[model samples]
Target: MRLLQVVLAAVFIIFQVLPAATRAFNFERPCYLRGGICLKQGTPDCEPFRGPCRAFTVCCKVKGLWGRAAAEKP
Candidate 1:
């Protein structure tokens, strides 16, 4: 149980610290450049891609889309 608690705590710390690290290094820019979005974990259809998206985030694609769509949202 202690080991599990320690692991959970470490994960929490990584989530907390990663955002600061990203701000310091501008790591999020690269993810944007790659057409990936960083979303909080458990968002639907989130498939992992390489990014600095902290421990609680998942780097996901915009469903095979690039640029704006011709169809308008009604």
Candidate 2:
């Protein structure tokens, strides 16, 4: 019974930690662009449309540069 409890505890911890580990990273704020220029208060292009505009590129979190998409809203 004690071993089972320990296993359950480990599983629970893993479940909690896994999500944090897999969390997405945001690279840039959602913005709109036109004619190859970024617009303020605009939307970005991506799979799920969160706002109006579209994303410029696949915004990914870079090491020295910016980060990737943080998370996608359902």
Candidate 3:
């Protein structure tokens, strides 16, 4: 129907007009400012950061030096 077409067009326009969420380097929030890395949930031995981060990602503590040197057992 013509009404359905109009509704669909409006919905498409609204989505296109909005800013898309992406993996861009985020420096404005407290997470990036405090050196938080948004790694996927449950990365082995990574400490969880209690700050806002990207969707489906957990802000993790920086595993510098010794932490990175350790090899994963697979």
Candidate 4:
């Protein structure tokens, strides 16, 4: 039990110590968007953007419609 507790603590500390920017996923930011399409201070096209959504968006979209990451050829 102590060994399991230690392992869990280590994992938690490692995740907590990661940089904030690395931990967050912003869809509007180009770096996060990568080669994907994003609104450039304007509305994006109604057609779904063909690339990775932000990490948070990924979770939400994944729960519903088929997301780009799932559709991409592996």
Choose the strongest candidate by TM-score.
1
**Most lDDT-accurate candidate:** 1
Residue pairs with colliding backbones in model 4 are none
- Per-residue C-alpha lDDT of model 3 across residues 1-74, encoded as one tens digit per residue: 99999999999987776545332333333443255455545667654434446575555444577655222111
* All candidates in order of TM-score, best leading: 1, 3, 2, 4
**Residues 1-74 of candidate 4: C-alpha lDDT, one tens digit per residue:** 99999999999988887766454544333333334333222222323433454432321112235433322211
Give the Å error, residue 62, model 4. Answer: 40
lDDT against the true structure, per candidate, is 0.55, 0.40, 0.51, 0.41
lDDT by residue (1-74, candidate 1, tens digit) is: 99999999999999999999877765342344255666556644544433556666655555445432121111
Off by over 4 Å in 2: 24-74
lDDT tens digits, residue span 1-74, model 2 = 99999999999999988877655432233433221222222234323323233443322222233422332221
Residue pairs in collision within model 1: none
Candidate 3: clashing residue pairs, number: 0
Shift of residue 38 alpha carbon in model 1, Å: 24
The Cα error of candidate 3 at residue 26, in Å, is: 9.4
TM-score for all predictions?
0.36, 0.34, 0.34, 0.27
Better of 1 and 3 by lDDT: 1
* Better model by lDDT: candidate 3 vs candidate 4: 3
After superposing candidate 1, which stretches have Cα over 4 Å from the reference? 27-74
